[model samples]
Target: MSDTPQSFENFKLNKQLLLAINEAGYEKPTPIQAQALPLALAGHDLLGIAQTGTGKTAAYLLPLLFKLKYAQGKHPRGLVLAPTRELVLQITDEVNRFAKYTDLRSVSLYGGVGPKSQIEALQEGVDLIISTPGRFLDLYNRGEIFTRDLKTMVMDEADKMLDMGFMPQIRSTLEVIPVKRQNMLFSATFSGRVEVLSQEFLEFPERVEVTPQATTAETIRQVKYAVPNLKTKIHLLEFLLRQQELKRVIVFTKSRKNAEAVSNYLGRRDLGEVKVIHANKGQNTRIHSMDLFKAGDVRILVATDVAARGLDITEVSHVINFDVPLIYDDYVHRIGRTGRAEKDGEAITFVNPAEAYHFDKIEGIIRMQVVELSLPEGVEVPPTPFVEKQEYEREIDLQKRKENPDFKGAFHEKKGNPGTNPFKPTEKKRGNKNSKAKKNRSQLKTQSKYKNK
Candidate 1:
């Protein structure tokens, strides 16, 4: 078995495996796969940097399955560490489908679900384990699973994993794994921290750079909208959905609360169908929502950044960003959920004044100016009043408190001394007033605490 070119026929893969690939309607290898597969199949460590939707999953998976098949190991021979449960499930789906003709048994382990099934899968001797860092480390520390037989280790979305503060967890796993084995790190971006982590893990690995890092999909028509507030966004979204006649849409938000809020707002406006999925939802709910959206049962699906990556649904006409993504790469992945398979799709982002700085970096990374799409005629939308809000009574009150020396919280002052007050009264009256103020302050603190809870 030697290096295989991009041609499917020349790869000389097992007939059944090739048939599965053909059945999947894949003819030629993607750039990442074409360049990295040969080296990976040769048991060489590799660092593959490519943007999303560039066939990254297949790039590492095909060679991994083939290598696992020939290596002949009774124990688990390969391990893949992903940052999120969705990504883990996505990768497991790819590997299981590609290995359908082979004898390899794979299992995916992640949180937000019970581990009894995962424990059982390990007991049955899985050859490949696709897992998130937390759940995998949990099982490892409990003495229920062993990494002694692990030969090939892959960190998918390596930059994201580190960005989400998974360094300690990843360090723990890396410290225990066998050092003299094949390693692969794949991500959409290459930051300095990612480069440092790669240097720490890989030993003179072959580097493969297919697309420019942090590049958005060229197939997608990127545009931005300047909206003032929530009400304007609602109106604009309704108008666009009507004009563009979006058959299916995925709206991305920054938080779970926003997902729910946007979904409810759209539903209240009598939008045909809407759903939301986030970590707060149970796995069954999330899966059901995705299935319904994929089958065209739902018209719009609102989601957070966690669901932005690894969604395989096609035919999504539009991806509207209800909230501009905090991370630039996340914006890329969110828009990638649409415009797949040679389809022309549109990505529209709502840029409030607060989020303008975020888009500046995003524009620089994509290397193209995001077209500024104007509002429809006579929309009567107002711009965000950030300057006026800063000059309001709230700011005056804050300044007064900071500048005045005698200003207490609407009561007694902590000035020179309580014993010698400017407005002296009877001793009993003073004690009573002080006690009343203290009691009121205590009650206020209690109310504040309870309200927050």
Candidate 2:
């Protein structure tokens, strides 16, 4: 046996949880867990900024379980808020696994499903609760779950929570929870919004940021391709998917429509077991689809922004950006799905020529130039030409004036002025009838001259 004590024992967890940890085969502590556990066990608020797949789930789950177990019967003693239903479920799973040997019970609350089941679970006064912000607040509003005795609150994936527009829900939830207990904020990327959340939620917390902020995981190989059009994007994606037989792949699209379209296209091509998950799908469908993907029954998963935040599938071998992520932080989280647990993985992003600006921002955040992937032969790629609308309009206006002989000059000039009359014969203007007679004589003279020519 190693000289170092078990992680559970080191954290001074109760024997039951310790037994569960050893039985679960957790020998060493992941970096985030190792650093954040001790402080959390001491009831101190902690800000843990680590990349995805660094065992952040266990980092908070292990200690929170111990805290709840140590102080039993404090109804709804711990609350964990995740940005997405997937992450909420994931946290619940981790807590359940860690607390298997203990009397610590946990309930999951999320949207897409009805509140009937969730309310029933809450009515039972569970020891711990993990939930998404919207569903949690919903249940709270219905008097199903209250924050009266909430001793420890943990926000998992705080950065993603902000990205998903959960700030309002999160802030309101914080208002209900007791301020006397511990607060922990964990995320893959830390932004100004995260700082604001920390200031509002945590009280002089110990900050522990393991990886460099604005950086992607070190194990992922980032690849970029400069494709021209949407059709070419599909062509390249098809070629790549065929070239490498990925065990489990995720294709990220910019919109739900595109995700469904991609899923349909891949399925039509006889690609192995393609599926889609987005807001449009019912909760049961999403949960079942994700479970199938995790079970390896579905090989490819096409998803929109909703699935970008909280997916924790470990077997995802490749992450392809069918549409390059517009937000810089999303790029980090997407690729993070792969290359987890120090496993080597590939992240290939399709960069449409028009989206080059967005790609530049993503590259700047990851702190490295993404390697360009070569396109298959005979593919036409379009370039985004720089055309200023204002400049083009000015040129078109000038051309229109040049083509029209009736165009008027900006400044009016005396027609008979010495310099202006160079091409005109000098003539005297007559008044009234005299002017008519003079105009008729000029017309007759011009007609006779043209006839002679």
Candidate 3:
């Protein structure tokens, strides 16, 4: 319990884990690892509050590896649940890397692919099973996997799991697993939802906060550009990518359609081997794209929030937010992809008028104002189109209505006659009056003809 920052050796971790750690070039424990490792090793239910890339993975993995030094049974002794397939794979890779010196076997289970391989891996015997909740449940329900022997259950990125509406699955998982197992929950930001989730899952847990909640890494320089529309944002993106300093960039859009569109735009513009990844993409495609980006074969990777949480590429020089994430906490995870491992990086956000409200919320959550910069002089700043302008206005008005239910938005204002109720029957009544007058005229004409005869 020395106040001085100590090396990994001081943790008294398994020699095999120490060898792997040294080989991985990890000399000193990160703030999170140093604080959480001892408590976790001591078998405490832990609620660790720290952002991604804070070595939370290692914090949990190291202690778990020590406890399960070698593989013993066909059933998994360690279970790690993540929100996305990418995260499942990432955590699995970390396990493989750390447990290299041991006989421990681990497998990653996620959907979007055949389960035959996963079932086979489980059959062959795995000590650790890293998985998404759905695929794990699928396998468990099919009797292809068993978890009665699970000694440790780690919920990595627990906040994201809740954000993605995985609470029910997590609850189901809780019901299936042994109630006596150790529980560890890690999150970048601890929201009210996470607090409630922790209450249901964790015992009187040791609370570990490496930094203040929802705080962005100081290593990343954040800036924003108020582009007028999507087209302008694209032009701005192209302009920014032209700079030599912006190498190994990840452009995050809010939707799959935008991710693909951005990738196509960049590819057409010859912006150096662009790749796109979203839920729609095949599992192999996502994995290949990630590999290419990691190898520097792809210069820019355009992605949605699916890749926001657990991507561990350390050399990302820039993170461009083509669309401001509506979920403000996601903005923290997005920016976290860069400025990882204490490397200085940049996070640039393109905020159209429609997204300005979301951008403000992001600022509020991060507790710092992102410096708004004027668009680069040479870039063509296109005018916001009529459709986009209306959309932006409507979004703003909707947000206003949410805040003040009585406040009628601009879109709700009466466009025609102020005194007239558009939903009323004034037109129908006028039509009936005209018809009656025509009938009276017809009767009068008949009477005139009879008098003339």
Candidate 4:
């Protein structure tokens, strides 16, 4: 072992793994690989704290491959868990690439489609398993997967898994696996929650932090625009896409509806083969969209947070946040899609009035203010509609109420004010009530006069 394994050869990896690494065009060890590989190769449970695109994948993969040189028995010896289907597929591809020269077999399991093929793959036998928590657990419960021979378990994007509320599944998976197996957890951000998870999962694990947690990549140039509303954001996005510098881009929206809207708008405008992906999209559709983007057939990809974690496309030139992520930590992951592997990239955020607060939180988390760029001259700056404005104000007030229980939001009005109740027809109801009262009084007076006569 060398003090600084500057090159891949310095690690003394297996010949087949080395050959595959070389063929994949990896010249030297990344900072994470240089630091973590030695410990991982020595069979220590590792807690690697490194952001996406820091070569963390290779840091763990190389050692695991080296230890499990070839396919052993029918059951898998190595298990890797990711948070998303895209990530599972990405990991599967990387596993195939790195294990090309060896006889190792890998299978990826995720829930969007039928599990028939996945069950078949598991039955046929594999050396490695890359999967999402739910699908893997589903198959396991059905007696489709056998984990008796599992020797290594790697949890990639551990923080995202926790954020996605997969802790129970992770725990259940842990219960079924052998307690004597090696455990490895890698995450971009090591928050308190992740630390707690590590305590339960790892045994005296060696902590490795290549970069500070919740920090954005220095290679990315971040900029922001304060648009009036969603329509203006769309206009500005179109204007930006017209610029030739934005060659390959991913536009991130907060909701599936927005993702589809942006993708359809770009497609209608002929903005260079736009494709949309979200939870609603079919499995094959999502895979095909990603394939098109990766192959350069599509210039733009519109996606929700599903694409924010563990998507490893290195050639992405730009990341546009069509809507600021409500969860501040997600901003880091969204921009991370670009600025990967020491590459220069740009991340532009479109902040509408409603999203400004969320954007501020993101800036606070990143510890840097994004340079506010003026809206392009040609783009139409429409006035925010009353409905949209009220919605924005309502959301802002809700957030404030969360921070301060005594705070009254914009939606709050005097308790007795009928006008404040939007759902009630105050004017119409009031007039009808007065007219009915007057008619009843006249009828009562006439009935009294008739009785006296």
Candidate 5:
């Protein structure tokens, strides 16, 4: 790690790997790859702190591939566990790319699909296996996977695995994999649990952190729209998407319902071909949508946080947060989808009044303010619906209680205010339910809201 190897040849990589990297147009190592490849080549257990688009995949893959030069056994000699199936498939693609010249073979294991084909692939013989922890353990329990030959084990996207509660399955995996093996854990952020697991299992790993945790790429220009309700947010989103600047966009929503709604809304309009992906979708459908987006057949891809991590789509022009992510860290990953390969990109977030508190927390983590833009003229934004306003107030109150245990919410009576509930809306805006419904809804009211870029 003293001075980064200026060229890939500095590591003395096998000729096959060199040829592959050359053909793939990778001449120099990225920051993460520069720091990580040497240590991995030296047979060190690696703990790499890197976000997506940092070439962390190749950082470990090169050395791991060198160790397993060619496929020699029926069982896998290298194993990688990722949090999601998309990530597993992505890593499998990298393994195949680097191992293309060599006789190396790999198979992907994940849920939402039958295991019969995966079992058949393993039976046909593979040098490497990339899988989600749950699917790996399921196959292992079924006596389909053989791990005695494993020489190296990697846990990619470790933070995500912890977030999704894969610690138990990971522990079970530790009990089964061979004792004498190299371990590597790469993640964007390290939680307490991830730190403890690395200490207990990784055995004094050579740690490499390429950037600050949760810090966004400088290549991404960020902005936010403060709107009153979901209905208005949709209107602004449609207006923005109509602009010619937004070529390839990924719209991130908080819920599967929202993803489908947004997809349906855009599908009925003049917005380009739109596709939505969530856990509820079948695996083939999700894969098909991803392929279409990557191939430029689909112009807009709507998704929940399920698509936030491990998606490697390149040249993404913008990432739009239709709903502010409740999990603060997800804001980073959602925007990370764009601004890859040092290309300039934009991140646009829609923050309702209820989500402003969470958005503030997100800013604190990223250490920068998202530029606040004024709403564009000619777009009609409706006022906040009473039912939706109630939901927002409830969410805000819940957030306050989560931040502080002794918080007396807005619904609770205050000492100085002699009232049962202190948060009653003005009668002019929120009249009786019947009267509110009878009024002609014209436009949404907002303090601020847009960027042409």
Candidate 6:
């Protein structure tokens, strides 16, 4: 532990753990893993600042599993709480991989399915539990979870947890657990809310940051296309997918509606095995879709921001932003889906005039100016639909007004502002034009007053 280890064998890990780590395809530790492993194995409370796909799951798991060697107790000795069901499953997969050679027993609890199997697994026995906050709370409230033996607690994607309004559940969880334990919190970005959570969660913790907060991966080649309409965006996506090298791709949309539309469009176009996942999809359906994508059955997976944070599917060739994310931090997660495991990746975003404003915010958060590319030839850039154009204009106006309260957008210009609009008359001319109407209003007011009297 005194010197930096170039390989996994250099770490003070058990024979069984080393075997599992080797088979799991880990040669050397990721930056987060490298820094956090020693601190965590030394029984220090760890605060890991890392985005998704940085091998953070293993960062906490390696040290955690090393300590829980051979699984002695009936109740869970380690508990990892994540924001979404997908992430819980993801962490569970890694735990299984890393603990393959050990006698460790881990159970994953999530929503979308009945808890019968999970409760049965718990009743039998488990050394570790990976679960979503809501599902974990549900099980705990029903007297299903035994936390008396929980020596280590990990909260992954803490920032996303706050965004999803899991703070109350998280607070309740803290009260229920044993007062003394080793706590670890990992977040992609440490916003104010995450900082507050960290203050309450960690006690004299060792902070390990593998990357700057909210920064996108440098390995990703990012490009933005100024699309005029949804149809044009679809055309551009088709154009990109037509290329033979885009073997595995994930198209991230802003909503379930858009995800479905894009998926359906691709499916009909005979684009290789397209599937979509969002909140509207059943849990089983979503899981099945993810499995298909991971297994190479589905070449294209259209998703909303739900899959942005923690679902780890490696070697994803491209991440296409069909719509700019509403939350700026999500841009990091969306692109982080690619460029995984330090591999070169590509991210292409389709931004209309309305979305350009949000994309600009994304660039600001990532601290880099993304390259804007001209539309490829043969892809028809059709005229934007009237309704869509109006919506974009309205959105742009709202963004402008949000930034500057004094902004009188082109759509909302005062009718009498002469310089602002060529056809509009001066204020004096407007007052003169309405002078007769003003007198009529005064006469009506006097008549109404007399009537009241």
Q: Return the top candidate by TM-score.
A: 4
TM-score of each: 0.82, 0.81, 0.92, 0.94, 0.90, 0.90
- The residue-by-residue lDDT of candidate 1 on 90-137, one tens digit each, is 898788688878878888999998999889888887889899999989
lDDT of each: 0.82, 0.80, 0.91, 0.90, 0.89, 0.90
Q: 71 in model 4: Cα distance from truth in Å?
A: 1.5
Count of backbone clashes, every candidate in sequence: 0, 0, 0, 0, 4, 0
Candidate 1 regions exceeding 4 Å error are 1-6, 70-74, 378-453
| Every candidate's CA RMSD | 10.1, 11.4, 3.5, 2.3, 12.5, 5.8
**Following a full C-alpha superposition, what root-mean-square deviation does model 6 have from the true structure?**
5.8
Tens digits of lDDT, candidate 5, 1-453: 667777899989999999999987787898999999889999999999987777889998999999998879799999999999888888888887888899888899999999999999999998899999999999999999988999899999898899999989999999999999999999988778779878877987999998888889888999998888888899999999999999999999999999999999999998889999999999999999998999999999999999998888777999999998978888888999999878899999998988899899999998898899887896788888878888888888888888997998866666786754455663554557657555433222222222322
Q: Give the TM-score of candidate 4.
A: 0.94
Against the true structure, candidate 6 reaches a TM-score of 0.90
Query: Over the stretch 162-257, how does candidate 4's per-residue lDDT look in tens digits?
Result: 999999999999999999988899999988989999999999999898788888999999999988887898889999999999999999999999
Q: In angstroms, how far off is 422's CA in candidate 2? A: 41
Ten consecutive residues with minimal summed lDDT in candidate 4? 418-427
- Candidate 5 has a TM-score of 0.90
- Give me the displacement of residue 292 in model 2, in angstroms: 0.5
Identify the runs in model 3 with alpha carbons over 4 angstroms from their true place. Answer: 1-4, 415-453
Winner of 4 and 5 under TM-score: 4
Rank ordering of all candidates by TM-score, starting from the highest = 4, 3, 6, 5, 1, 2
